[model samples]
Structures are given as structure tokens and as C-alpha cells.
Target: MVKGKIAIRRITSPKSRQVTFFKRRTGLLKKAKELSILCDAEIGVIIFSCTGKLYEYASTSINSVIERYNKTKRDNQQHHVTAAEIQFLKKETESTMQQLRCLQKYNRQLMGEELSKLSFEDLKNLENVLEMGLKNVRSRKDQTFMEEMRELKRKADDVEQENVELRKKLRVLSQDHREIKGEFAAETSSSKEMSKSSDQAMPDKDDIPERIHLQLSLQPKAPSLDAHETEIK
Candidate 1:
């Protein structure tokens, strides 16, 4: 009897699923090995079980096969560029170069260079453009100069105000210093006067005999002998 082909579906039984997985994994690896040996070609197979187990077979080193595959993919991509695409790229390049040249020429003209090829009308238009640009530049320059001047003036005013405040502070300090000096001088003078009075009121003990001698010397002397005789006559 001819058996019917089994339908492809998920196996619900755990035991049957595990047994099927083991058998398929072993068969797949065996087929890969046989194919590699018979064909003498590189082969690689990777499988993952429902339990997240990894199984792989490689006739050559896996790394070498992956590198060769990536290199071939890159080569195929490079070879896939058509003539139309090349032509389109060339056109784009030429357009970009042409625009660059035009910009360079325009810059030279603006700089008053390469004017020999310009017509009279073109030169007139260029002259107008240059004049307008110069006028704008001068106007901006004047505006910037005025702004800077205003800023500088403001700064100078601030500095002047600061100087005024500082001068006021200095003046106040000077006045305070003068007042302190005057008070100190007055105190010093008072101290000196008090000291002098104390000295006069309380004379030194050693100076008492000298003061007494001075007073005796200053007293009126007794009349001389001649003066006394004249008085008697």
C-alpha cells in the first residue's frame, strides 16, 4: 500500500516533538556532511531547537564562508550598476562642476576681475550691483560705528559716575580724617595744658631748695655803706 504524505503542522505531543527534533537535527547534519563530501563544495547549516539549543555544520570554517558570502554580495552590488545609471551619475557630476564654474566666474566678476569678456551693458549692471553692495556695506559700517560709539559713551558715563561717587566717598573720608585729627590735636593740647598745670602745682622736691634760693637772690639787697652814710648826713 502506498502511504499518504504527512501534512506539515506543529506536533502537539511533547515527547513526539522532542523525538522528531532529534531525528531531524541528526538527519539535516548528516545530509549537509554528505553533500559537502560528494560535491566537494563548501556547505553550512544552522539550526535552533524549540529549547533554544544551537546546532550548526560547516564543511569549511564558518567564518571563511561568511566572509566569502559578504564579499560576493558586495561584488554583485558593484556589478549591478547599469550604463544608464553611470550616465546619470556623470550628468550629475557635470552639472555640479558647471555650477561650480559659474559661481567662480561670478565671484571673479564681483571682485572686478575678468572684465575683458563682459559687454558694456553687463559691465553697467555689475557696476550698479557693486555700488549697491558698497552702499549697504558703508551703511552697516556706519550703524556699527554708531552703536560702538554709543556703547563706549555709556561706559564712559558709567565710569564718570563711578568716579563722582568715589570722589564723594574720598571727600567724606577726608573730612572724617580732618575731624579726627582736630579732635586728636585738641585732646593733645588739653593734655599738655593739664600736664603743665600739674607740674606747676606739684613742683619737684629736689627743685624746692633751688626755687627758694632763686627767690632769695631776687630780694632787695641791704643798702650799701656809702648810701647809708649819705642818708645819715
Candidate 2:
């Protein structure tokens, strides 16, 4: 015959509760020991009495069992985290690929290769963008040209100034040469004049001896006695 099920309730009497706790605790421990032996499994049980007493059992050391459980739980959590990260990476890669494709299509449209998908408004916008870009390019070109022109003008001015300086130096050199030539010509003329005056002042070589004879004759000569006797005879 099958026995009726007993209702599970808290025992109201203190003594009865203590007795029930002891019996249940012993039975639970026995069951755990049998399960561990028969199944070759590690098992653990823990209980706390109402009086704050503690009881525990384990096929292995409790500390070792607890440590193994924590290690397994941590490993499982890490595996889940790794799977989540992989999923996130996959989604990120898909999003990036989608963006890349969009960019490629947009680039093709800009190059006028894939324009069938563009509406009139989009074409107008593209035209405006191209026009603006052209305007900016032209502006930059003009700016660069002006800058180059200014640089050339500056260089030309420098060259012109240098030429003017060279011309001034040449004029100074020419003036100095003319002055030196004039002084040389004056010195030459003075030398020629001095030579002519010296020629005019010098006496002839033939007259030099005659002039010396006249000077000797002019000196008082002693009276010739023979000449005076001849005259008296």
C-alpha cells in the first residue's frame, strides 16, 4: 500500500525541532556518502542549525572542493565573455564593410562611373561641389601666380639695382682713368717743355773754345820788347 504524503512544515516545539534536525542531518550525510561512492563523484553538503551550529561534508577536502568549484565557474564566465567579444567583433566588421561599400559607391559616383542611382537633386549637388572645387583651384592658382610674379619682380629689382651700382662704379672708374690720363699728359708736356728750354740754354760745342781764347786775350799782356825795337828802327 502507498503511504500518504506528509505535509512539510516547521516544528513548533524546541525539543522536537532539535531531534528532527539531528535525524535529517544524519540521513543527508549518509545519502551524500553513498552518492559519492556509487557515482565516483565529488560531493559536498553544508548545514547551519538554528543555534548557529555549523555542519559540512565533502568527498574531498571542503576547501579543495570549493576552490575547484570557483575555478570552474570562473572559466565558464570567461568563456562567455570571450564569445561575447567575438560576436561584437563580428558585428563591428560587418558595419565597417557596409561603410566601405558605401564609400566605394560614392567614390564611383563622384568619378562619373556609377551615376544611374543618382537623382536630379544629387546630380545638382555634385555639380555644385565640382564648381566650388574648380573655383577654389582657380583661386589658388591665381594666388600662386601672383606670388611668383612678385618674387620675380623682386629679383628683377635687385638685378636692376645691381646694374645701377655697376654703372656707377664704371663711371667712377672712367673718371679716375680720365683724371690719371690728364695728369700723365700734363707731365709729358711739361717734360717736353723742359727739354726744349734746356736745349736753347746750352751753348754750341765749337764756340766754347773760342770763348775761352777771347777771355785769355782780354787779359793784359806784357808789352813785347822786340816789337817796340822794330818800330823805332
User: Residue-wise lDDT of candidate 1 within 1-233, one digit each (tens)?
Assistant: 99998679999999999998999889989999999999998988878899999888899988788888899999999789899999999999999999999999999999979999999999999999999999999999999999999999999999999999999999999999999999999999999999999989997999989999999999999889999899999
lDDT of each: 0.94, 0.93
Q: Best by TM-score, which number?
A: 1
For candidate 1, list the clashing residue pairs, or say none: none
* Per-model TM values vs. the true structure: 0.57, 0.43
Please provide, for model 2 over 46-91, each residue's C-alpha lDDT reduced to its tens digit, 9 standing for 90 to 100: 8899999999999998898899999999988877667688999999
Candidates' RMSD to native: 9.4, 14.9
In model 2, which runs have C-alpha deviations exceeding 4 angstroms? 1-3, 9-16, 80-100, 107-113, 125-233
- In model 2, the number of clashes is 0
lDDT of 1 at 40: 99
